[model samples]
Target: MTLASDDKVLILFRHAKAEQVYGKADHERSLTARGRRDAMAAGAWLHEHELGPELVLCSTAVRTRQTWEAAVDGGACGETVEFDDSIYSGGAQTVLQTVREAAGEAQVVMVVGHNPTMAALASGLSEGDGSSAAHECLAAGFPTSSIAVLRYAGPWSGLDIGTAALERCHVSRG
Candidate 1:
């Protein structure tokens, strides 16, 4: 389903930091206190910017879930988070596919996951004309709880490298 020009926006967010438990599985690792604070800050930023996502696609990992929880608690987004196991280990292509599969009616969609897939996806989609500061931040690295906002005119299925403009990038500071 192709969309009208300038009708779609994608926000890619990396999950906040998590504690490195010596014996815990990566998927089961939980967020640290700092991570929780950062997640809340990220959510607040989204709310303040009025970029709240209509649909949130999040990874099923414990840390990701915790991050989303913190964000929602801070009123960053609305209800209805779809947690997908594939996102836990998915690469850039997988992330793109997930975004493509989002509901057609959703104007704003947010993905909360991990990196380097998040970083790669943001870097791949950005055309570098939106904001120089955003481009530089994205290039520097995708720190935990970082967000990359991409705007484009096309169906989610049509998302491709350099097809969207990097509107801005935000990194949470706890």
Candidate 2:
């Protein structure tokens, strides 16, 4: 598909599953073995799809950080990721604002954060004009390590509810 110069790709990635441990703060939880493998698979998938992100906005939580690290180990070719505390608990609106702040010059941008917010943002921004199967998969659920690939045909600052199309969606499992 031919994309206009203003077109941009937004990849909303939910962090892989984290171990459920007692006495640990939610932000301190770490990824489980399965979570690590799944994260790696997600990285490989991103690499294979050529969704080369110029910037990654990730949550400051430990599991989220580990998820990015594992994805890199699996060949996600990104050098730097901006860890934002807002993404950890900031509502979807705050996360959107953060992403808009990154509207500099990148064609592809990825955000790795917790669920509910990720799922909500993905669904809210989608114009429902892309892959039907992907849409179905996303509607089913935004599981751990799942990615919602959205195409925004405008500047990041121009993004808003129902302004982007859900290009593709996948659940990465290793």
lDDT of 2 by residue, 1-174 (tens): 335788898899999989999899999999999999999999999999887788999999999999999999988866458999999989889999999996477778899998899988988888576789988988898899999999987788998989988989999999
Question: How accurate locally is residue 167 in candidate 1, as Cα lDDT from 0 to 100?
Answer: 84
At residue 163, candidate 1 shows an lDDT of 91
Off by over 4 Å in 2: 1-3
Pairs of residues clashing in candidate 1: none
For candidate 2, what is the TM-score?
0.95
Assess each prediction's global lDDT (C-alpha) against the native.
0.86, 0.90
Weakest ten-residue segment in model 2 by summed lDDT = 1-10
Q: Per-residue alpha-carbon lDDT of model 1 for 1-174, expressed as tens digits?
A: 234655788899999989998999999999999999999999888888888777899999999999999987766875457989878878988878888886466778899999999988888888576889999999989899999998877777788898988988999977
Model 1: residue 14 alpha-carbon error in angstroms: 0.5
- How much lDDT does candidate 1 score? 0.86
